[model samples]
Target chain A: MVIERASVTANELIAEGIFQMNVSAPKIAGENPSPGQFINISVIDSWFHPLRRPMSIAGREGESLKIIYKIFGAGTRLLSEFPVGSFIDLLGPLGNTFELTEGATPVLVGGGVGLAPILWFDETLRSNGIDHTTIIGARHSGEHFLEHCPKEGFILTTDDGTVGIKGTVLPTIESICLEMENPKLFACGPEPMLKAVKQFAEKETVLCELSVESYMGCATGICQGCAIEHKSSSISEHSYHERFSLVCLDGPIYNAKDIRFP
Target chain B: MSCNLTVEIAGVSFKNPIFVASGTFGYGLETQELTDSSSLGAVITKSITRHPREGNPPPRIVETPSGMINSIGLANMGVERYIDTVIPRIDEIGTAVITNIAGFSIDDYLYVMEKLEACKAPICGYEINISCPNVEAGRMEFAVDPELTGRLTESLREVTKKLLIIKLSPNVTGIASIALAAEQAGADAVSAINTVFGMSIDTQSRSPYVQTNVGGLSGPAVRPVGIACVYKISRKVNIPIIGIGGITSANDAVEYILAGASVVQVGTANYKNADTARSMIDELELYLAENGIENLSELTGGVIPNE
Candidate 1:
């Protein structure tokens, strides 16, 4: 990972409280970044705060990168207020990337703000000439981010029934898997939604990988801030060789079977 | 005008007087992509014990407004595996090394030391970590009393002829007495002020945030505690002091040095900026140059005492 000052080319409101920022960073744009890798962004002119906000790479457009940030706290709120053509500090592309598999039908599922990273994953699958299915959900109608997404072969769900199906993503997940011949599961969302997807994939004997949204510190693995418990015998196979792994280092992306949920 | 930022402690010279504090930098392998480890004065490895520890449960770290509290519980890959696997990686970095040793008992420490002695890794010194706040063992207990601190330092003194620097805990009544004890027991230098004791509770969950109920607090919030400790301990012992607390910039380092710390360690600030130590080193040089000072040693103990 390298630290670079990225200039904001476009910062627009895609949804309420959620802003899509397109930045021109040669250092980040120069790398072959996969889905699920993130950038740790610092609020401009805010030195009192001692932590950076971790924003996932929404998509990549030639020499520019896209990040969808939610106005959660002071740091992010300040970040949303920055005018276009301003330089912002970003330490990226930090963390491990998602493994793209061939010959298997890539199934992209996400809920709420977790759909941010899935957007990039969708772009990658399409650019590789791979046929895929996209499943998305959010809290309500206006909260969903479906901008510029392909309309065909898409399933939409929401909690309040204002958009599509009046249910959670878990119930719709099973029927979607049954229709596909060779389904590969990839999901990112709330904790309960991720757990549901993991169980569905395991029960159906399908491969599943999850991008967890755990709180982070350095995003570089030193702070040990984003640690999650894992099944002891799971991650020992890889070079990580640890019982517990940092979300920033070992993964923001983990195989569904490898981690032990609390 | 030459700005001399290097410092010599216990016959070992450091490139600068800033180090990435233990627990912040994990064995120097984790942050290699972010910053060059060799740029700092000396790299201190995370606390290594005899056996592998899995550390604490989930929610290990929580960040407050100004600082953070961590209860990692000294989880590490045992000394044998460390000397076998980790040492080779650290040895490749072209910088001086100091292995921070943390154990529950004296033998646990001695066993780690004995194993390290046989290893060919070029570890420059051993910073005796008798003051880790996250563990529920006798490690922090050793620094609470002067006699215990003295005996532990003296025992390790018999084991290795290498440089020995005792790191002090801030959760003590008389920190000066503990420093004096370590110095009298043949310690080469002392690291003043480990993390102070603290805890946080989640109001919505109605339970402790960290599994251990309490943890070590670091960052700018703990800087005052560290400055006071360095001021008190410097008068009691003549050993060089490595001040570690909430050092973020050159100004924080100046406060510690003026308070009689020979050098300083950057801890919690590293979480936000991976190269806090390296940046602080450059800032120190700039400060020296701006003040028309040639030697960095002139800042140490420059604070005036009110008569």
Candidate 2:
């Protein structure tokens, strides 16, 4: 991984509390970071906030990287206030990337800022002339960003009846999988939501890939702080201890069958 | 005149005095690409146990005011895998390497130590980790009691002729007594202090932030505690002191040296910047030169008191 000063190219509020930040980081971009990989951004220069914040790559262009984040705490609040031309120390292209298998139609599922990686994955598939479906869920219309995505094969859902379907993303995922042949699932979101998706895919015996999230101390695998439990029956290559996988090194992207919610 | 950063601990020479604390730098391979880890005086590998441990359940870590609380529960790949996967590549680090051993019992520690002794890796010494607070097996019992600390140190000292350093915890009532016990029991040096026991609660959920409810705290918040422990232990023991706890800058390292620490380790700050310890090497030398000091060892226990 490389640490570089990535200057803010743009930071725009796409939804109520969500923002899409663009930075010019040739050093990180030169490594050819893929979808599902993340960059740990150093927040304010203070002792209180010592650890860097890990943000997934939402998109990438020539030498620019895009990150979508919601202001959940003091760190993100400060990140939102960075004016254009300001530089942020970034350490990346970290963790494993999403695996796209041949003959399997990709079905991307996301919610909130978790949609960042999914959006990038959708763009990647489209650019490759590959066929895929995108499903997004949010709390309300004010929390959704449909305009930023392609109109075709992109579905949006809301918890309240302010958008496409008045429910969670599970029903749409089920319906889409029932009709498609060789459907492989790709998902990312808050822990509870990802757990739900994991369970749904496992009951149906469908192949699924999930981008997990955790409170990381060192996004470089030194601290061993981010622990994701291993599924007892599943064989894993990265489970050195035989029971846990560190999200920073083993994955942010994992085959759902290899991991279990703990 | 030039400043010398090299330090000799128990007859083992280090290129500098900036060592990356155990459990913070992993096997010294995690951040090789981000920083020149070879620039460090030494690297202490994570605590290796007899059997591979899965560690504790999440959320394992949470950030507090100026520090963070962590209950990793000594999660590691066990001693066998460490030797199989890490030891052969250990020389790539290009610095003095000290292996940190943690176990639930004296036998467990000896078992791992004996195995390492047979491997013939370029390890200069062993840092006995009897201070990890997150695990239940040992409950860090050896760190709190001087007699227990002495017994553990004495047992491990008989196994190897290499340098032996006892890592002390600040969560005890008499930390100096424990350090003295290790020194009397044949420990070559002592490192103080490990993390301070701490906890945090979330008001909204009315629950602890970390799953373990309590964890070991390390960061800028614990720097004073570390310095105090080092000063106290230095007064009690004649052996060299390795100061650890939230050390981030050369200025901080100097403070530890003044308090009687022969060397310092960068802990939580490594998370903020992996290159922290490597950068401090030059900064520390510059510090000595600017002050007209020729040797860093002279600064150890150099704190002046008011008349």
Candidate 3:
């Protein structure tokens, strides 16, 4: 992990309230970051915005990395206002990455801003000459981020019927799971969608890895702020401290079987 | 202009007067890759208990306007594992290490102290944590009650000749008396003002943001409260005062020194920038040089009030 002062090369809105920012972060980008790792960004160095917002790396090319974020709070709103050529402090590429199995049919699912890591994973698989299925979900057609996604082998779904499929990504995921052998699910999204995916993966006995999201402090595991509950009472092999899995250290990526959601 | 940043706390001399507060810099090894830890005067490890604790459930922390509330609940690897894993590697850090010990009972604290004292890891001292508000066992009772604080310090004081510093909380009516009690009972120093009790609500859910309902608040928002506590405690205790709470830069550290702290620990600021405390050593030297002060200690309680 490293702290780099990355300059914003581009920041553009791709969908409703969603933005894609490209930064010139040689230090972090040079680390060969895998999917599911993230960069903690500090927009303003003031008490008003004390903690850095953790944004997953959507894509990376040489010395440049891409981050997709939604303008949900003051921290992100300030991030959206940073003009090109401005500098932002980055602490990353932190957290563990998604594990890809050799010969396992990959099924990638993403919802809302959680699509960042999935898109990166999709591109990684494609580059490796691996065939995979991709699903992107948003509330409606206007909220979908398709510009950054590949044109082929992608399924677009929206809650409303204004998009390709008028439902969540679960149905498409189920169909892919049924058709493929040794299918491995890689997913990121809201809690509800993840829980649904977890249930489906467990019933079908498919391997599943999830990229989690949480409000973090120190992103380096010093603060012990970002915590998620694990399934086991005894410490799992993945846990560093105890029962709660630190999202920053042990994961921002976890196997769905190891974590429990309410 | 030359200045000395060295400070002597309880007979242990530190290269500089800046130390990373406990709990903020986990074990001091977690950030070695991101920042240089050896340059720090001292590294205070997170509070270690007699047994391993799982801590509270998820949603353990939340950011406020200019601060954050954390209810980590003292989740630690226990004293035995800490000594086994972290102590043997202490020399690698190339700086003094002070293990912060926390427990539910007097024996619990003594157990940790004895274990640490018997070790040969060159630990600087012990920072007795009696101010954790997240746990239900004591609920910071030792910090609020002077008698309990005196007893806890006196018991641990008997077990070791090393530096004994009692961490104090700000959620009390008489913080000075607590510091005085620890001093009278043989505490070598007192680190004033752990997090102030605070809470934040999520409007959409209309409930507490942290799972523990209320946690300790630390950041720039609590700097004045910490400075006031240090000043009040400095008046009653003869031992050195180590100030901690929301210190980000040399200016904030200087404020604590002027208010009566012999040294300052970077707390919430470490979360934002782990290098803040280490960098403050240079900044502090520059501060003393520019102000025509030859020694950094000369600024302790230097604040002048208009009568």
| Top lDDT prediction, candidate number | 2
Candidate 1 residue A145 Cα shift, in angstroms, is 3.4
Per-residue CA lDDT of model 1 for A1-262, tens digit only, reads 7888899999888876778899998898787677899988888544466778888899888778999877776778888877899998888887787776776787888887788788899878777777888888887878776632435556778788887776887777777778888788889888989989998888888888999977676787666667787766544422233778888888889999988778
Query: How well is each residue in B1-307 modelled by candidate 2, as lDDT tens digits?
Result: 7998889998898889999999999888878887888899999988888877778888899988789999998888889999999999987888888999998778888999999999986799999998743244346578888888898899999999998999999989999999999999999999998889999999999989889998999999999999999988888989999999989899999999999999999999999888988899889989999999998899999998559
What lDDT is reached at residue A174 by model 2? 92
Give a tens-digit lDDT track for model 1, residues B1-307: 6799889898888888888788788787777777778888888888888888777777787766677778877877879888988888875556888899998777878889989987856788899889642244433588898887888899999988888999999998999999999999999999978888889888889888777888888888889899999999988989899999989999999999999998888887877777878887778888899999888888888889899
Ranking by lDDT: 2, 3, 1
Ranking by DockQ: 3, 2, 1
Name the regions of candidate 2 deviating beyond 4 angstroms. Answer: A148-151, A234-240, B132-140
TM-score of 2: 0.96
List runs of model 3 lying over 4 Å from the truth.
A147-151, A233-240, B132-140
RMSD, candidate 3, Å: 2.2
Worst lDDT 10-window in candidate 1 chain B: B131-140
Each candidate's interface RMSD: 3.3, 2.3, 2.6
Considering lDDT, which of the candidate structures 2 and 3 is the better prediction for this target? 2
Question: Which pairs clash in the backbone of model 2?
Answer: none
Q: A1-262, model 3: which lDDT tens digit per residue? A: 8889999999999889999999999999788899899999988977677899999999999999999999988899999999999999998899999998888988999999999999999899889878888899898999985742435778888888587777888887898789898999999999999999999999999999999999898998888889898777677443346568889998999999999884
RMSD of 2: 2.3
